[model samples]
Target: MLHLRVVCPAERTEDVLRVLRAAPGATHLVLLRGAALDPVGDVVEAEIAREATDEVLSELCRLGVDHSGGITLETIDTALSDAADRAEEAAPGEGADAVVWEELIARTGEESRLSVTFQAFLTIACLLAAVGAVTNSAITVVGAMVVGPEFGPLAAVAVGLVGRRWDLVRRAAFALVAGFLLATGVTAAATVLAEGVGLFGPGVLDQGAQQVDFVFQVGPFSLIVAMLAGAAGMLAMTSAKSAALVGVFISVTTVPAAGFAAVAAVLGRWDLCGRSLAQLVVNMVGIVLAAWLVLVLRRSGSSVGGRGSRGGRATARREDNGRPLAKG
Candidate 1:
């Protein structure tokens, strides 16, 4: 369930109330006229079924509430009311199976941006991977996988493609490419410096990294694992089961491949470097492809799960042309 807080203009309060009262999945409508000082209007609050949220938000956008007033949606972690129960039952589908697109797009947008924090995490993850590769440590490779933030932009790319958000796709792609390049370059430089300081031997990776050799072993299993991890990651995100993210994080090998590639290039092992690059590309492509496929399936599913959301996005997109599906 989602708790909706709406600050509506004085004249539009009745329209807002009517929409809420008429919505099957909306309950506990409370209206306080002239209670909003900043917007200087009325405050309306209600609990909405997650399955029905898209339509409700779309209607609110149609009324210009999002532009002129304000609307906020919060997840209700522990609502014990029978009214909330009835709201869920009255809605189109189960809450957990529903996809709240606005929330997803907004979240991915922020995560996919090129920020200082993103650079730091990517660099650190790559460095950890490089060390793991030279030392042939699977544990360190796993740690690098867990520490990597590449999934965010990768997810953004999938979400953007699904939602027809070209700008987001471009931004995410740039961040993904540029971030890996910078981190891999830094890792390569570090590898050279380590050799100069006698920290690493000249032929450390010549033995093919016995334990962590899988990082550069590009093959069918690599793509399959990445695809499976991508699908699971998208499902976890859409269903709001964030705990599953840890499993997804430790399942892919993009970070480790980048680390290995950097170290291999520094050691003049072009063969290993090429294979590691292939592994990295395969994982990235498989993840984005699988994630996009999952989102498309969810969006095109049955009315019991996709009715309000599908229609709402279509409706809102039509009404508010080129505005990111109602622009909330």
Candidate 2:
């Protein structure tokens, strides 16, 4: 359920009230008047069910309440009285199946931006990746992948494409590019310094049998794994299965590839550097393609006359038909 708080001019109060009263899922209407302060006129409060939210919001938009006034809608977890009972009866399944794209964008937006938390995560992940490459340990590489904070911007790009929000798309793309360059630069400098101090050697960069596993190898399997991880990552972001997102992070090789490239460059291994760069490209392309596909599927399935919408309406209609008529 959502709690709608509307503040509008006193003159349009009747029109706003009519819109809310006629809305199919609106209940617990509370009207207040004469609270005008600083060009405000009146306020109206109501509780609305989730299924009817789209229609109610659309009506509000049509009424011009959003212009020259204010309308705030906040999700309410609990309520008291018969309205609460009705809300419980009308609630969507487990609250996980519903995809609130706006909310998802907000959450990921907070993560992907160059905030203190983002910088901290990137720094730690890059250091971990550099250490892993120096030691030639796949386990450390995997740990770096899991720790990297690049997934948020990547997912944001996909979501922006589907929603056609160019602002979000631009911001996400900028963040991704900037974050990668920053991480790579930092790791590369660290690698060079470590090598100068005799902590690492040219032997670490050699493509010999001893360090074969550290060499980047791009193949069809790499692309496939990246694509699968990207799709799962989007699902984890949108659905209730968010715990699986960490696994998705570990399954991809983006951060590790960048780290490998930086380290190889420091060790003067051009061949390994080239291969690592290719690996990074392949993984990013695969993940972006997969994320776009997921968004397309979600949009197609949620159209007004599509299966998901129809199913929601059918369920509501069935309940309406069997219920006793209430006095107005």
Candidate 3:
């Protein structure tokens, strides 16, 4: 379930209360008139089922409550009230399958931003992947995959496309491109340092025991695997089934391939570097394409189901052809 706190202007409090009372998925409504000091309005609180969050939020937005006052949403980790259970049962879809779009946009907005922490993780993951490639350590390669922050930007791109947010798409694209270039460049420089210390050699990457050597080899199968992983990753993200992400981390070779290419470049192995670069590019393209496709299908399916269901529009407008009914 989700908890919502709304500050409603005196004139609009009745409208807000009416919307909440009319929603079967809403429960435990509490009204504190003129209690808000910051926004100087009445405070209203309620608990709502996950399946109905979008629709309720859209109604509040349409009532001009968000603009006149404010609306805050939070997850209720544990709700002991029987009303909450009844509210969930009253909703149309499974809680886990529901998509809280406002929450998703907020989460991905933070993840897709090009911040220092994001750059640092990408750089470190690439460096670790580089070591794994040269040392033939599949374990380390998998570790790098798990540590890589590339998925945020990739998912941001997909989510942006689904939400029709061009600004998000541009920011995610910039972050991904700049991040990979930075990480690959830094990893290459680190390889030079490792060579000087006798820790890395040019032939280390060519060793027969290195299963990770395939990171530099591009094939049709690589694209297929990357695309599949991308789809699975998005599904896991949207459905809150995070445990499925471990498989996604291990299934794609993007980070490992980029690391291999970086190391090969520093060693003047242009042939290997070219192949690895191709592999990296192919994997990224495939993953982005697949993720976008998956999100599109999921969004479309949700829209269709929402429109056909009663007492559960899930934020869709009655006359907007499946668009959320938020007023400006």
**Best candidate, TM-score-wise?**
1
Which is superior by lDDT, 1 or 2? Answer: 1
Model 1 earns a TM-score of 0.90
Model 3: CA > 4 A from native:
301-328
Error (Å) of candidate 2 at residue 140 is: 2.5
Q: What TM-score does each of the candidates earn? A: 0.90, 0.75, 0.88
How much does each candidate deviate from the true structure in C-alpha RMSD?
4.0, 9.4, 5.7
lDDT (Cα) of model 2: 0.69
Question: Clash number for every model?
Answer: 0, 0, 1
How do the residues 105-195 of candidate 3 rate in per-residue lDDT, one tens digit apiece? Answer: 5556567878899999988889988988788888998888888888878887887777666666787899988999999999988999999
Candidate 2: regions farther than 4 A off: 1-56, 69-82, 91-94, 108-112, 207-215, 301-328
**lDDT tens readout by residue for model 1, 1-328:** 8889899889999999999998999998899989999888999999999888877877786787766677778888888999999999999988888887766776677778888999999999999999998888999999999999999999989987877666678889999999999999999999999999999798888766788989988889999999999999999888888789889889999999998999999999999999999999999999999999999898754331122445435433432343332222
Q: Flag clash pairs in model 2.
A: none
Instruction: List model 2 lDDT by residue over 1-328, tens digit each.
Output: 6678788888889988998888766788988887757457888988876555545555664566655466666777667778656654665443444454434545555544665677667767877877877776778887888898888888877866765555556767887777878888988888878888899677875544233243378899889999999999888776646789899888887888888888888778888789988988888888878988987885544432121333223323322344211100
lDDT of 3 at 110: 64
| Shift of residue 131 alpha carbon in model 1, Å | 0.8
Ranking by TM-score: 1, 3, 2
Cα RMSD, model 3: 5.7
| CA lDDT, candidate 2, residue 234 | 85
